[model samples]
Target: MIRPVAVIGAGPFGLSTAAHIKASGIPVRVFGDPMVSWRDHMPAGMLLKSTPAASSIDAPRRGHTLADYCAAAGISRLAGVEDIVPVGTFISYGEWFQRELVPGLERVRVVSVDHRSAGGFEVELESGESFTARAVVVATGLSGLSHLPPELAAAAADGPAPTGPVSHSCQHHDLSRFAGQELIVVGAGQSALETAALAAEAGARVRVVARRRVGFGAPPWRQPRLRPGSPFGRAWSLWALSHYPQPYRYLPARTRHYLVRRVLGPLGAWWLRDRFEGKVRVEEIDRVVGAEALDGAPVLTVRTRAGATGRLVADHVIAATGYRVDIAAMGFLSHGLRTRLAVSRGTPNLGPGYVSSVPGLYFTGLPAAASYGPVMRFVCGTEFASPRLTRHLVAAHG
Candidate 1:
């Protein structure tokens, strides 16, 4: 009997990979609610860092691009590089793609995945149902990977909740809750800057604190045209990283990790500058050394580049600190399975076609960024990842 391939997420990576596998005449089962992360975790007025051209969910067949969705849905299609994509619009497009290509997607949660002694895997769902699959692709995206700095984590007495004195930026879906309150947003990246802007526009007193000077991306017209363009930006380096990800794994482990962290380092969108610049107070400091709740309000102790220390108090603190990929955080993978899989800096050590050390196990999306380059960190990477992994599965398991 042939078992279906299990794709453990409904996000861009999982949906695109499952669509490709199904197109190749392979049976696939996709799990998780469609666009749940974008719809639930992201703030209400957030805009995607990716441009309209780079925001499509890849599909095996044609007629499913973001342009197609916008045309069909009567929304004006945005084609210019300066045209920004709203998170809400992207979420709707993803749901549309799921309905069109991967209609059989299961909206249930996968409680655990364990390897069978005889060779496949046992997948247990939250509904108490179990199934076996010949192969498993862990495309869970950034669900369990929200990272909070140690200083801020200690300040949240009851843990980082959306309504608490200290919380990670990923917790809130609406910034209006903080209206008429004081907010101190930590980090210089798009998430922090945008969250501060949104909160200020919502009538909150907003301030931004960063370890370094805040930077914004260059205007699209100012980008150098001598080099070929990639979804990230127009540069020879960005082109190579986005197009030739297969070679990225062969680089030295230190270099690979370094590039993954530094290539797309902290920066804000050019369009967001007007909304953020004068509206919020931005403070450049050495680091946030400590944080604590004082009088039920969050107080952050910071150091200056000149070796001076000071404190900033706010009604609440939002740690816009980004995500960190750690396979161990994936509680669905049994401890035994996690320990057996080889990893580099908490990410799976992937081989050709996104397969991990375990023959039948695979991972993609943010988890693959370390091995496949920074392109895997965005939705457009599905264009390169989906077909390659699908081909590998067909050849190896067929």
Candidate 2:
């Protein structure tokens, strides 16, 4: 019997996973479009928060990398977002990767998914067509889930009324779209900072809401010992290394999870803090209490940690709030698959191999990131994830 597998999503993770599986010569069907979400969402003039080394999809077999592309074009590689890597450019790279590496990918969306009574899976698409396979892998990026603070919903509903011109910064594209508009940005992460910077350059009067009394770092970092080449190379890469094999499991579960939070969340904030100064106002330890439309502007009642409260008026409001991965949000999930997916804190319970407790079902990307650490979400993890997932799936079917 010919073994078949279905791979969902087409971002870096989905694309890379498909490339690897295809190379293994397994019959694989991939769903979704090139940069479907990334190209359509994300504002214009946005720079990548990650460096070239960390933000690339690993090509299979012969190995053409982002570095190869840059070198071929004589484009110098840098460690930081010194310049914006346009979504269009990345989309182009992804297309080239697909055509040059894994051709014949299915470009339809998985409108719904169903598990066969005899085992395995089937995906029903919007076109009323369904494909069945022995296993399915979900690699959709943050496409299915994003959190818009409940506080902004009412104002957002009011005639698309912006705080001053408020919108979730993710939807922001061309700077020319908001020339001379007053914008209030929320959050201190890369997306928030980049949105504010781009809006400012677009000539918008912008101020960022840094609610933390003291904002966090711009990117997570670590002590010198954790570098990949260091003696305690694992420890040296601490800031960037979200996990460390057997050492992590030996520790108490709470302690292990604590270490993960410290390294991935706060460390990232620390690495990027210095960049926010002057470019945007930082309101540390502040909270958005309530927002109401006053004189056609968003009047946000904010309370600082010091117990002082005030109002901020802006034409628009941007919530750089991060994304979520609850499987329920994925419209494509079938009741059978949903029931089978292991649940831990509303996410799939993933084993060490990145397989869910559901036997043949596998997971990659954010779903596995919690257990696999930050690497699952980064492009760098393809080396570990792709091979592991592909090998396991192939062996089981073979």
Candidate 3:
């Protein structure tokens, strides 16, 4: 019997996994616009938080890497500790990787994935084509998962129309459009701080209203170390988490959950420190009591850490809040399949080999972070996820 697999994302994990599957002698079809999120969602001129070495897609075979693309394209091989990566450079590298390694990747969107009655998965595409495969891997990156606070969501709904003053951080590709206007950015993470700085540089007067005092990450290590590299900062704990992903599952569930959340909590990148400080005003508001639209402007009522209440008015509100992965938000999964898949804290619960409760069904990337650990949340995660998943699949069916 010929067993084939369908990979439903063309991002780093999807492309990496598909490349590994093909290398393992298994037939696979990978679908989606390559690097769509990086190309369309992120603002131009944005820089990656990860270093050059960690910001690569893992190819099963040698010769394909971000460094290779940079060398071939005559761009600076951004491998130095002080070197910062631009979003466009990363996207171009991914496109190059797909072309060279994961050729035949379909640039079509996956409409739905349902279980075939006999066995395997029935996949539908936006072009109205369909096919059946023995397995399907959900590698869709942060799509349909941008989170907004409840108060902000309600205020956005109360407007005369959708897409009002309130917008999630992922929705904007160009921050320069808000020029000469007052903008309020919420949250203190990299996205929030970077967006605030970008908006300011774009000529928008921006203030970041975060619940907690802002924090910046330590500068990247200037020299190589004995331990392996990780996208997360250089810490013994992070090094352990990066290297021992499979073993991380054995720890208590609460411990796993806490590490995932706290290890990389709201902190700005080191490079962003100069641009964000003194450039953007950061208010450490204790809580957002209410958000309302008054005469088309946004008003945020908040209490300070000192327990004083005040209001901030801005022409628009940008919630730089990060994404939250909930399997139910993935509309492509059929009701029957989604209902059957087990979940932990809104993420798909995966067993060994990253397989969900439904046989041959898999979840990687952010959705798998809960089960796999913090490494799954970054592009470097493909280094671990791709080979492991491919090995399991090839052994089972090849």
Give me the candidate number with maximum lDDT: 1
- The local lDDT score (0 to 100) that residue 249 gets in candidate 3 is 70
Off by over 4 Å in 3: 1-3, 158-163, 221-229
State TM-scores per candidate: 0.99, 0.85, 0.95
Expressed as tens digits, the lDDT of each residue in 1-398 for candidate 2 is 56478888888788888998888888888888877767777776555555555666876675467666556556665334333355556666677777777677778878886778877776787779876788888888888566677776666664332334446655656656666877787776667776777777778787878654434432223434334431112345543453343233345546545554444442223334444557666666467887777666777788887889888887777877666568787767877778777675556767655677776678887776655665665666665677778878878764
lDDT of 3: 0.86
Q: After superposition, how far is residue 30 of candidate 1 from its true place, in Å?
A: 0.7
Collision count for each candidate, in order: 0, 35, 0
Give the clashing pairs for model 3: none
Model 1 lDDT per residue over 1-398, tens place: 67999999988899899999999998899999988888889999899899888898889888999999999899999778988888888999999999999999999999999999998899999999999999999999989899999999878978898878899998989999999999999999999999999999999999999998998999899998988999989988899998999999999999999999889789999889999989999999999999999888999999988889999999999999999999889999988889989999899999999999998899999999989999999999999999999899889885
Q: Which residue ranges in model 1 land beyond 4 Å of their true spot?
A: none
Q: What's the candidate order when arranged by decreasing lDDT?
A: 1, 3, 2
Report the lDDT of model 1 for residue 321.
Answer: 96
Task: Say which prediction, candidate 2 or candidate 3, comes out ahead on lDDT.
Answer: 3
Question: How many Å off is the CA of 83 in candidate 2?
Answer: 8.8
lDDT of 2 at 188: 62
* CA-only RMSD, every prediction: 0.9, 3.9, 2.0
Weakest lDDT window of 10 consecutive positions for candidate 3: 154-163
